[model samples]
Target chain A: MEFIFVLDILGVVAFSISGVLAAMRKGLDVFGILIIAFATSVGGGTLRDVLIDTDVSWLTNMTYVYVIIITTIFGIILRNKLNYLRKSLFLFDTLGIGLYTVVGVEKAISAGLPPVICVAFGTMSACFGGVIRDILCNDIPVIFHQEIYATACILGGFSYFALAYFNLPQDLIFIISGLIVIAIRISAVVFKISLPKVY
Target chain B: MEFIFVLDILGVVAFSISGVLAAMRKGLDVFGILIIAFATSVGGGTLRDVLIDTDVSWLTNMTYVYVIIITTIFGIILRNKLNYLRKSLFLFDTLGIGLYTVVGVEKAISAGLPPVICVAFGTMSACFGGVIRDILCNDIPVIFHQEIYATACILGGFSYFALAYFNLPQDLIFIISGLIVIAIRISAVVFKISLPKVY
Candidate 1:
């Protein structure tokens, strides 16, 4: 649990930096950049909590708020260095989504939702923060037409349920599920893979 | 209460029809159209309910589901005739926002939120459905750039609180706030008015 918490914080930091980068490219003011960072870091989890009728974590947890704010500050000051760090940023984002996918599925299970809904929640947890950020920035969500992002999260969720059914160690199932997401995303980007478009 | 219920149904119908039109123009398929219709009709209220930590109305109540489905069917079947009804369609859309602004303010009050937050909630409820619809269709939201739409809702919310402070009847306050929204929208369109952009 402590390990997962640390990964989650790392994910938030990576996502916040990405948000700042995107907002800066759009020429948004500092306030706008902060909001974009907020939306990117915690938007998915907030949506999942709302649907499951739980208290929104960021509203009660000051840690996320502080982390994102601090991250945005650093991202802005170090914007010039970010270009050199793209590869590492991508790695951090993949890890973040992997952890978030497992976290979302676990929360859904605790809420007593059905299997399909749990998988949907998992994907939502990992993907919708980017979706919300893209929407705020007036772009079509990358997952909708271009990336294999949500697919990786969905597959990881399926693996989690499958491992649990086989009576695997709970910690093993969690780690493997997250690792699968990370592996798939990294491979997709490296291989220039994408989802096929109907149009 | 019955009158409010009737108005709410009308608002749902109007928003759903608008959603259908937007999807049709975007060349979305039947399934896509239905999803857009659902989002535009209930997305704002759902966000509000989620933030307030209340039972999401559409999840528990079948009325909204039935209303949007029926509205979409009619909207698709009568798309050609819809052009002739542009004036009436705009009227319906305006009325819908007016009702939603008041409904959102009322809900925030019930949740015991502060006045400024209530106004923000009111504007969000009146605008975010269309915002979501536009985002899904990959367009910048109209309210974000050119329209005075959200401003009307915010002002109406302020009016709601002001009237309440004066010890006006609850029903009167509700009706007046809604009327203010409708009037502002109509006047804006009639005079070709717009919100000034910083750029």
Candidate 2:
């Protein structure tokens, strides 16, 4: 549990930096950049918590708030050096989504929601933060574009249910599910694979 | 209670149409238009419900979903003739914020949040749908721009608290608070009153 918590914080930090970079690319002010960073790090989990009728996770734990603040400042201070770290940041983001997907699925299952809704919730938890971030930045969400982002989460969600149905151990299920998400995302990016355009 | 329910439905319809119009202006497809309409109609209330840990209002009663469907179809069919009804649509939109603000404040009060949070929730309920709508359409929210939109809701929320403090009747408080919102919004538009740009 401690290990998962540490990974979660790392994910939040990675997403926060990603948001700061996006905001800086758009030349937003300091306040706007910080807000975007916060949204990118915690927006998806917040949305999932709300939908599931749970206390907002951040409100219950001040650690997430402090993490966002610290990350935003770190990201802004290191803006000039970010280009060199793009590959590392990308790896962290992929790992973050993997952890986020498992956490979302586990929460929904605990709430006794149906499997399909659980999967939906998991995908939403992993992807909606970026959706919110993109929206606030006045751009169409990248996930809604040709990217395989949400699709990777969805696949991992289905994998979670399949593994659980086979009576897999809980810890193994979490590890396998997270690995599947990371694998799919990395594969898609490396191969330049994307969903076909509808229009 | 029946009157409030009726007013709520009217507000939903008005916001749904507003969303459809916005999506159409952006040349979104049918699915995109309907999604925007749904978001604009129920997005605010859903946010409030989630934050307060209540069953989502729309999921409990299917009426909201049906209303969004009907409103979307109606809006798209009447799109060509909508230019002539801009003033009427604006009036409906204003009345919507009025009802929404009151409903949101009442709900937050029922949930036993602080008065400040209640007011914030009220303002969010009245205005966040449009904020979501604008984001989906790839624009900065109009309320965040120089518009007096959220300001009107904040004023109405404060008015509700003031009226309640005076020991006003429940119905009277609701009506007066709603009217305050409507009046402020209409006056702002008529007088070209707007917030000054900070940047």
TM-score of chain A of each: 0.98, 0.97
Model 2, span B81-101: residue lDDT tens:
878988877887898899999
Best prediction by DockQ: 2
Off by over 4 Å in 2: B1-45, B48-53, B57-131, B139-199
- lDDT (Cα) of model 1: 0.86
Tens-digit per-residue lDDT, A51-93, candidate 1: 8988777754568888998998888888889999888788889
DockQ of 2: 0.16
Q: Write the residue-wise lDDT of candidate 1 on B2-91 in tens digits.
A: 887877888888888889999999999988999999999999998888788888889989999999998899999999999998887788
The DockQ of each candidate is: 0.13, 0.16
RMSD of 1: 6.7
**What lDDT score is found at residue B173 in candidate 2?**
93
